[model samples]
Target: MSEPREITYAQAVREALRQAMQRDPQVFLLGEDIGVYGGAFGVTDGLLDEFGSERVRDTPLSEAVIAGTAIGAAVTGMRPVAEIQFMDFITLAMEQLVLQAAKMRYMFGGKARVPMVLRTPAGSGTGAAAQHSESLEAWFVHVPGLKVVMPSTPYDAKGLLLAAIADDNPVIFIEHKLLYKTKGFVPEEYYTLPLATSEIKRKGKDLTLIATSVLVARALEAATQLAQEGIEIEIIDPRTLKPLDTAAMIQSVCKTGKALVVHEAPMTGGFGGEIVAQLCASEAFDFLDAPIRRLAGLDVPIPYNRELEKRAVPQVADIVREARALVRGEY
Candidate 1:
């Protein structure tokens, strides 16, 4: 087997789209500024030239239309990968996504399939402010039919994306805006990672830290710092949020006897709460030496000021502090 190659998260996603389109003629892309303009973040850059205008389409500035069109194509036996400019904009198409795309398969009694992928950039870092930088993944995870995926590294970004496109259900594939240029080792070959599986990125026996999206990277950094102080933190990244890998998480928490859930989303109504609740209700509850804690973003609009924005979300130091408190029985 060949060695894995290093590439940016954005490049990995582009490669997945290219390979999927090449392998299946039924696969096509449609979204605002996705064609000649190469998408808002350039993830779809250069595809228009290779696949032509018919396949790499540029649609109107209507999120509802883009989502509606993708659903229509998917039900008609076409694989449509639609892009929402930013996650915040997805609210405009919630009716189409939550009501139509999510309920199609069940409403049709498994006779219909919506093999479509809705890719959107989420989270805040580049100062896009409140309207452009929301991480509302919990909303989709609440829906029954939609599958939610938030891949952190370049490897999972490509692999999980391929799996999402191949699934016979509507997938909400969320990409973090700050992670676009982050580099990591990714296989050059076409590969797919299981959707509902969680990955233990780092192994430890001291404490279990379950982080999602951009927080995964931050948690790893904090782990490095804590390791120097003789505190080993086992980090688990739940790449797929909807169908969480609860068994894996339960096992980790049981072994460590302490757990901390982290995310960039607001603390109130965040996905972290679900993770904590799952741990509390599971057999892991008996094994817990401390209360399952959540370290998440402040429940406020993402600030425009740089420092304020930084304070809004959990930083590396914040993770380290929280982990120390949990391990030392200070929480």
Candidate 2:
């Protein structure tokens, strides 16, 4: 096969938005600091120049306003892509997201739809402090009618964002801030993949490691290091968290007979707990040779101190150690 096109994570997302915006007249962007500032991470850079301020309109520093406005625009026939500066700030717009966008269709007898994309950056690695660095995808995933997505690689970021924009339901598109500078293969042309699908990034028969966003990269790295130690690790990235690809999960666990769920969220009440429960509840539990393992963030606010912050969340070495333990049936 031919070589895949390489692109940065930020550029991959920009290409998705640019292509979708260029292809569909109804698609537009509205958020804070997007027009003149080029976005917090420059993901929307040059978009205003090409699409103009009319479509790439800037709004106040209010997540509620951005969210509510996008929902209204969507219901009225416009496809609006809203950007929340930080995922932690999403709480400001929770009412609009949960009450308005998520419930509008079900409450309205399925006659109306909230077709919008909420793009926000989450997780810590850039010394962004507590409030600026939070992985809050679990909060939204619990709500029905809202699609939650977290793409780990550059290719998935571009493909999933394109798929999200085309989705009929409201989608929470989360990007890990630390992954913006990372590069990978991205097709130059526009493409769309299903929102609720999971990807098997690496194939193995010894163990299954399911991760999201930044954790996917860390898991893959750990798998490479583990390879030298005579251990095989199968890695799965559930690009969409809400409609989690449980079938892929079951298949992986059935093959490996062991599973590990890792994320950047706090250990208490995080989504990993739910994932483990689901795997155990399914028929796949019978195939397991060892118990499932979860390695997540600590139950505390993210620290501003760089050294403390690094330890707050799961790291590469930690995943390697955890994976080793799980395979050894010691975790």
Candidate 3:
């Protein structure tokens, strides 16, 4: 075997899209400014030249139309991958996604298949402000038929995205803007990661740090800092949010006897709450040496100010502080 090649997260995603399209003629892309303009973040650059306008289409600035059209295509035996310029704009297409695409299969008694992938950039980095920057994965997780996936690294991003495109259901694939430039070793060949599976990024015995999206990178940094003081923290990334990998999280907490949940979303109704609830209800509750803690973004909308935005979400320091307190039984 050879060493894996390193590539930016955005490039990995593009590679996955190109491979999937080449593998299946049914695969196509639809989004705003995704054609000649590449994309809002250049993720789809050069795709138009390769796949041409028919497949790599540029749609109007209407998220609802993009989503509704994708749903229509999916139901008609076409695998369409639609891109919402920003995850926040997904609010404009909630009806098409939540009600129609999500319920079509069940309502029709399994006769319909909505094999569509809705890719959007999420999180508060890059100073996109409140409206353009929001971690809204939790909202989709509440819906039954949608599969939510947030890949933290380039490797997972490519593999999981390929899997999302092939899945016979609506998949809300969220890519954090901050992770786009981050590079990781990814295989050049085609591969797929199973949805709803949790990955243990690092193994430790002191505490379990379950993080999602961009926070996964922060948690890993915090782990390295904590290790200098002899504190080992296991880090788990629940890549697929909707069908959460609760078993992996529970087992980690059971071993370490301490757990800390972290995310970039506002703490109010963030997915972290769901993870804490699962831990409390599971058998791991008995193994807890201290209260499970959650460190998340402020409840207010994401601030546009650089300093304020940095303060709004959890950083490496926040994770370190919370992990220290949890391991020390400070509650």
Tens digits of lDDT, candidate 1, 172-255:
999999999999999899999999999999999999999998999999999999999999999999999977889889999999
Q: Local distance difference test, per candidate?
A: 0.95, 0.92, 0.95
Tell me how candidate 2 scores on lDDT: 0.92
Q: If the candidates were sorted by their TM-score against the true structure, best first, what order would they fall in?
A: 1, 3, 2
What CA root-mean-square deviation does each model show from the true structure?
Answer: 0.7, 1.2, 0.8
Could you tell me which 10 consecutive residues in candidate 2 have the lowest summed lDDT?
Answer: 1-10
Q: After superposition, how far is residue 201 of candidate 2 from its true place, in Å?
A: 0.7
Write one digit per residue (lDDT tens) for candidate 3, span 27-102. 9999999999999999999999999999999999899999999999999999999999999999999999999999
Q: What's the CA error at residue 14 for candidate 1, in Å?
A: 0.5
lDDT of 3 at 34: 99
Candidate 3 or 2, higher TM-score:
3
Stretches of candidate 1 off by over 4 Å are none
Per-residue alpha-carbon lDDT of candidate 2 for residues 46-150, written as tens digits (9 for 90 to 100) = 999999998999998888989999999999998899999899899999999999999999999999988999999999888888899989888988999999999
| Number of clashing residue pairs, candidate 2 | 0
Winner by lDDT between candidate 3 and candidate 2: 3
